[model samples]
Target: MSFPIELTAALTGASVNQLRRWSRAGLVTPEIRPSRPMLYSFRDLVALRSVCYLRSEVSLQKVKTAFSNLSEHDLTEHPAAYRFATDGTTVVVWNEDRFMDLVKNPGQFELVTINDVYRSFTNSSDRVVSDFEHPRENLSVAPDRIGGWPTIRGTRVPFDTIADLVADGDVTADEVPDFYPTVSPSAVADAVSFQEEVEGLAG
Candidate 1:
């Protein structure tokens, strides 16, 4: 799921300038790397959103240190498959009933209550969604579905994938449902308008 820089910025709550800066610093390089058409994968999106959360609490240099710590632990699984928590100084990854301190202690963890995990995960996810100021009511994200890609609610189809069909002039607005039967014309129109607003902000 490769998304353009502008769209990625819109979804991740990171500015276009921020994304460029992070990429150059190797803090969160896009999965699809090109100066002219920067693109990022689903995992990159999760990482970037996590970066946004960390940035609110810590410095970018600290983020670099935390990521360096995380790398040593080997993040081979899908990012959405795990949960994240931080204290503005350290980063941790939680899966099931256990949590690992990725920053201050790279390979150490302890059992934690589900309530504690829920409190942290919701904080991160809430910011990821609310900070975007998304305009379309029909659009949504779910970690259990489509790796948390922004989609038309109740369906796995990405809103951008359908919006692109019109943005690139491959299909007319009315024809959107012809390609994605699950989405309505009005929903597609709103998504295109919202996407244009996002790209305009990047420009």
Candidate 2:
């Protein structure tokens, strides 16, 4: 399912620049040739969509990491199901009982109420979608040759503090996890692929 640049950008809500940036980030691999604009594949869109889902809906770095871990896992089991439908807004992939409790008592989930969290979550999801539409910058780095790695820039930050800033807006020096670090997109992909291979060994 190859898509033209325009269509892919529309569906993912990523801009041409952002798409290129992601490609540079090694998050998505698109086919670009000299004198040719760019081409995207369905798989690429799925990867970007997954990234967007992680940043928004869950709002928990660890949960996002778990989701990525699940993607790398060899388990063929389908993702856990919830009672409500997700229009790709706030994804709820918990077990049945936990989901039920969330829906019955929304405030427990940082939601005003379980009965109506669906709508609110979905609405807020639009921002991430839009980020894809109008990306801030184009690819800062060029794609690499075979066996090349992603180019990561920023420095590392503690996972706990990162999570706190992303979630509760509270950050204490002690809350920061000593081991949290940043990696290039290519590195992340490689690590994920390695994890997938390891999980495959159990089979």
Whole-model lDDT per candidate: 0.68, 0.37
lDDT of 2 at 134: 17
lDDT of 2 by residue, 1-203 (tens): 46666656654556777677656654455743211467765445544554554445454343344443434423223222112222233433333233322222322332233533322122322211112111111111223322222122233322222333324435332333333345332333223332333355568
Lowest-scoring 10 consecutive residues by lDDT in candidate 1? 126-135
lDDT of 2: 0.37
Show where candidate 1 strays beyond 4 Å: 77-82, 95-97, 113-203
TM-score of candidate 2 to 2 decimals: 0.31
TM-score: model 1 vs. ground truth: 0.54
Error of 2 at 174 (Å): 55
Best by lDDT: 1
* 85 Cα displacement, candidate 1 (Å): 0.9
